[model samples]
Target chain A: MRFSALRVFREALTGHKGWTPTWRDPDPQPSYDIIIVGGGGHGLAAAYYLAKEFRRARIAVLERGWIGGGNVGRNTTIIRSNYLLDGNQPFYEFSMKLWEGLEQDFNYNAMVSQRGILNLFHTDAQRDAYTRRGNAMILHGADAELLDREQVRAMYPFLNFDHARFPIKGGLLQRRGGTARHDAVAWGYARGADEHGVDIIQNCAVTGFRIRNGRVLGVETTRGYIGALKVGIAVAGNSSTVMAMAGLRLPIESHVLQAFVTEGLKPVIDGVMTFGAGHFYVSQSDKGGLVFGGDIDGYNSYAQRGNLPVIEDVAEGGMALMPMIGRARLLRTWGGIMDMSMDGSPFIDRTPVEGLYFNGGWCYGGFKATPASGYCFAHLIARDEPHPTAVAYRLDRFRRGAMIDEKGQGAQPNLH
Target chain B: MLIPHPILGLRDAQEFTYLGDAALIDRPDGLANPEAFHDYLYLRDNPAGIHRELWFHEQGDRSWIVVTRNTVTHEILGAVLAQDVARARGRSR
Candidate 1:
């Protein structure tokens, strides 16, 4: 049912019984033309684009658990296209454009807030680096502004500008970049895909793949054997484990990244802000709580929980950035497994196994790249070619020494 | 999490820097087999259960130790000096 103001008014007058479930809970079919593993934001979005854009029929998205239960729900919900590399900027900018029209296109309230995002600089060298990054962002046709100290101070005066060690110099602001209601994004895509006749099968865990003579035939699942002509694995943290079922090892490591939200307060933060000297980035949610996170727990783990050291480090970074939030009681905290790649960029390419594709290695940037990741993944799966912007995200780039290392951190998954 | 250091009894994991899979210690001869080197650098087992990883004691003894820990439970199974493992593998500087 299409939701609108009139429908809401009518439903309110009639005891609100007209509302129905957003997406259908469908059982898996005997087989599908295409099957996407892991029905998180990326997988759901891929299914949506596949049905709506590519007009592919008989699509199924298999999820081990409920939708939006993974990193999509656990993230701080920030989105931006302020990357400094050519391999990443265009793809993310396309995602930003998708975000701009997402709510209307999907007919859902995703709360795509483009308040802005500011990356504060602390030193002259940092300022120069941010200046170059800002230029790169502008070169990619994305918005960027180099704000001076006065401008930053005027914008967010609560920041610790006079820190004894790391003084706030300036910031690079992306006026079109901000946060979104992350769970809503997953829901919207899932509903859109469902509306396009894609089966979203939950509570179905894929146990193994049925490969024969170097080609994938189907998957062995807890539900049963679900055959598919083509299979795409979009499982973020479990990329390695799932692909291993197909006898392939990936250059990905899973690490737990934790996020925190504080007790509700009056709105303070106007836009997303990142601490240059530290790993803390924060934004005030619509419900008034401050949502923030920092570096991932630097270890290989499949667990959804993190240790205390990284928590202390993130709190320290928050204190260093904004001393005012020191007393705000942390209402809750949660962790999600991240798929950290060798070169710190994602892979959206066909695996060595025929009829099998892979889309993972998002590291800390999965939520922001959801739209483009899904759209490009769908394009690749449908046409058997890489999207123009995602041409550099090849699986063999590491072996060829053509890595898109945004941080130039080589071969270290945790560092990425 | 506490790392049971081979030398020091038990050290806080905060003092160490993680470098991931201990297979990194078995560096392939680049000149002999560049393909093997590529595989060594890129591919990983990345198991969800027990993982033997390399951690550098950056803040404490500055020693590189291999820790056998369960990735699911975060339990430390054992710890040994990476140098010992390297010597056992017949490698010397």
Candidate 2:
């Protein structure tokens, strides 16, 4: 393959390109207007909105790992808004809206592809539930289409429509939905916030919080103590651990979910296919890799390595749905820790402490919900009020019997 | 390839060769072949996997199967229903 002169000329200057971070040094400022722990998608996004929306200049984002190295980089890169709950539907739609203009807002290509996502229905109950969900979304200005058997077969001919055990009845398609480059999402937010003069400190872990008179004053990090006027905890999986440092207990439980990918192949399947019956989903990535994942480890352990049972279960589901893909070689498998809540929703509100706030308990949908999570979190941080859509998701909603109760069964598969 | 108790609803039974004990024999022998290894089987010589002593659904339904087979090499030498094996008599009947 031959390229233009610009490509050849740029290749010659690759040696002089050096490693540089987006935001580096800052003054010896002892305090910030608001300090956000965990420089992930949610943290960086909150910082960006804090500067852009509220004009809060004294903001900082502390990260223990490199940007995009956490669960944001580990997810399957899906973006959708079709949900089953009142609390989740509107919030995810906001995130979906933010996703559409994300590339333009950050001036970085995040590959936000609106390829659509379909939730497969095997039983009548699931079909009915998803149909209602579709109607609800449509009522709320979300784009959706109910696809029947003929429609499903016409769209994805590779599906095992002839199978008897778990037949494909139909699906609810959210057309204004798709995937984005997860790493680009983090980098986009990082760059945008850095450009806004927000100091993003990496490789800095929040070890402890110094509290006095029922208020958080500063945090003790691995490097040194960085004092703050206010603190926000955006640690999704490590929410409970960080809350403990402030002498507070959050309504959070940790669960582990695994994602699998296959060896690259020519683009055969289009859009995202979700199997709600068997708890599985798959999508052909832009690079030809098939990204898929399912339910979390039912029990608790911080083990990132998934077990054989889940692997077998997910493979069986994939074969049951797309039998022809049985020959596709599996490339790798990975897992991420999820801070599951009893209600299967997220918490974005003030903590019991005066100066602390938490944005966590996102279930398995946290990756796709990053934008809305950050927006709501920043709203509560700036105005000292919870985002209207996240009003039902309180810290004590579980005990108050006001749980969002998505899927309508009450207890969760892992959190219960 | 065969279980004389019942064929359930998945496959067609080819043969039921009885060894010395109550176990239905399915190995690299005169009766068994390599044709039935797609859906799932508890037979002895499946190329990808051979689940020995697997408790499959019989009489149209069944319970959870608690059996053992080779982990490294999927070789199922023998398998019987756990409940049946718990009350199973001594050697080959």
Candidate 3:
């Protein structure tokens, strides 16, 4: 059922008995026109757009577990498009626009908060880099403002601006960048897809791909064998393992990226602030908890938990940026599997196997690119062509020496 | 995590940089063979249990070391200099 103020009022008056499940739990059909692997935000959004935008039917999204159990639910929920490279800027900008209208388009409250995001720069080199990045963002039609140390001090006076080792010099702000309700995005997309006659099958783990003569026919799942003419795999952290089932080695590595939340306090952080000297980024949640994260646990693994070293590293970065964080107690922490690509970007392209497609290698950017990733992936699947904004996300870019090295960290997935 | 270094006793993991799968050390030479390079670059056995990985003591001794560890439990089995390992494998320089 569509949620609205009127509906809430009516339900409140009538004992709220009319509310229904967000999405149905139906058995997978024997065959479908298209099947999307992994029911995270990207897969669900792809299903929703495939039905709504592409006007396609007989679509199914297979989830290994319940919806929002993966990275979509575990991320820090920050969203921004302040990228420098041409291969990335326009696409993320498109995602920002999609996030802007996502709630209204899906008729659900995804809590699309555009509170703004700031990337702090501590050194002269960092300021130069951010200057270039900010100019690139402005050129790509995205908002950006470079603030000096005094201005940043005025905004966040509690920060450790005078730290001896890594003093805060300035920051690059994107007024449109912010966080959202990560789980709500998945639920909203799932509900929207369900409304458009798309099947969302949960607890269905894909064990193998049913391929014949290098062409995919369907998939072998824990539930049963489900047939599909076209299949799209968007499993974020499990990209390598899932594609390995089809005998395809992806240019991706799985790493555990952890996020943490602190005990609830009064609203303090005005916007998301990323530490320039290190890898820490933090934002205050609506519930008053400080949400933050740092670099990925720099190793290849499929596990959902991380070692203590990365935690200590993240804490150090946070403390270096804001000494006041020492007063707050960390409530909990979580880890998400990141599909880190060799070039530090993502891939949304067709695989070698005919009728099979792949969309992964999202590193830490998947949550922010959820909407555009699905839209572009759906476009690729439906039209057999890459979206204009996503043309650089081809699978053969590395092979052809046309890699989109956004961070210039050549071939190191962990650094990305 | 405390990594027991061969020279420095026990060093905190924060001082080191992790690089997955020491198999990267055996990187194939020559871009002439694209498939071989692709296999060498992309394909890796991401085992859940025991693994051999490379860790650089960037903030300490500036040495590259191979650490046998378990991915599942985050246990460090042992650590030795990667140069020593390479020498033991009969490689010079």
Candidate 4:
């Protein structure tokens, strides 16, 4: 059933019982043409595009848990394409364009808000860095603006401008960057994939891979052994654990990144804002809760919970930016396991094992890269070639000394 | 998560920086073998239960310590100076 104003009006006139499930709960078949592991946003989007664009049939997405049970549901929901690197800017800008038409294309209300995002600067060096980044964004067909202190104050007057430690100098604003309903993104993609005849199987955890003479056969799952002609893995933080089952070790580490939401209040923040001197970035949700987060726990763990010190640190950063946030009671906090790559960039390439593909190592950028990640991943799986925009995401970039070190942090996963 | 430092008693986990797997202490000579270096730098044993990891006391005494902890429960079993562990393991660097 397509959602529209006419449908709503017709249903309101009737008994209002005309409704259907978002996506069907389908059982796994014996085999499929293509099977994607991890039914998060990327996997589901890949399946959707593979069916809709590539016109592929017999596609299936296997998930260990229900959809939206992973990082897709546990994020701050900010999206932007303000990147400095040539390898990253164009790709993210493509994602920004896709996000612009996502709601109409998927026929679901994913709440793709373009309220805008501001990255505040504290010092001269940071201003120069953001200036270079904003120029890069403009070159790549994405909108950007550098706002001075007066302009920033004119926009957000309640910020702590007179703080002694870190004074706000200026900011780089992207009018197209904003937050989306995270879970709704998952649901919309799942529904779109199902509409295109892609099977989305939940609670079907893949246990092992069936490889023979370097060619892939299929996967062994909790439900049963399902055969596939091609297989792709996009299990986010579980990238290493899952790929290790196929005798391939990835340059990835699992770290728990925590996020928090405050008690509902009147609208305060107009758009997403990040601290220049700290790791805290916050935005007001449509429901009025202040959603925010900071750095990762700096430890390697699969646990989806955080300790107290990081919480204290994030609170301090928030207070340092806006003292008004100190009064808002913290409602809840949650953690998501991030697959931090060595160079802090993602990978979308085929493995040495033929017919096996991998896509992960997103670090803090995964949520923002969901649409492009899926679109490019689908292009790769269908054509057996890397998308032009994702040529730099090759898994062997590190070995070849061609690392896309966006943050210039070398090969440290935690630092990235 | 309070890591009981062998010297400083109990310290907040945030005071230290975590690096996974104490086995990384035995660094392979990368110039000798590229594959060994790749394995040494990338591959790691991400077990679910008890494991030993490296933690730097960045905020406190500036000592590199090895902490034995459970990844599932976030329980710290023990913490010892990595220098002592390295010396005991016959490692110079």
Per lDDT, the best of the predicted structures is 1
| Model 1: per-residue Cα lDDT over A225-255, one tens digit each | 9999889999999999999989888889999
Candidate 3 at residue A229, lDDT? 91
**DockQ preference between candidates 1 and 2, better one:** 1
Tens-digit lDDT track of model 3 for A1-416: 77889999999999999998988999999999999999999999999999999966799999999977999998999999999999999999999999999999999999999999999998999999999999999999999999999999998999998899899999999999999999999999999999999999999999999999989999999999999999999999888889989998778878889999999999899799999989999999999999999999988766788878889889999999998898999999988888888898899999899999999999899999999999999999999999999999988887788888878888888888
Share of reference contacts found in each model: 0.90, 0.00, 0.38, 0.42
**Of 1 and 3, the candidate ranking higher by TM-score:** 1
Model 1, which residues run further than 4 Å from truth? none
Tell me the lDDT of model 3 at B28: 68
lDDT (Cα, 0-100) at A323 in candidate 4? 96
What lDDT does candidate 1 reach at residue A295?
A: 94
For each candidate, give its TM-score against the true structure. 0.99, 0.78, 0.95, 0.97
- Candidate 2: C-alpha lDDT: 0.73
- Tens-digit per-residue lDDT, A114-185, candidate 2: 999998888889889888999989877789999998999999988887678788999999988999999888
Ranking by TM-score: 1, 4, 3, 2
lDDT for A374 in candidate 2 is 82
Per-candidate DockQ vs. reference: 0.89, 0.02, 0.48, 0.57
TM-score of 4: 0.97
Give the CA lDDT, 0 to 100, for residue B19 in model 1. 93
Tell me, by DockQ, which candidate is best: 1
lDDT string, candidate 2, B1-93, tens digits: 223232233221121211111233222343354333210111112111233433344333453232343322323344445455544544243
**In candidate 2, which residue ranges exceed 4 Å CA deviation?**
A1-21, A25-28, A412-416, B1-93
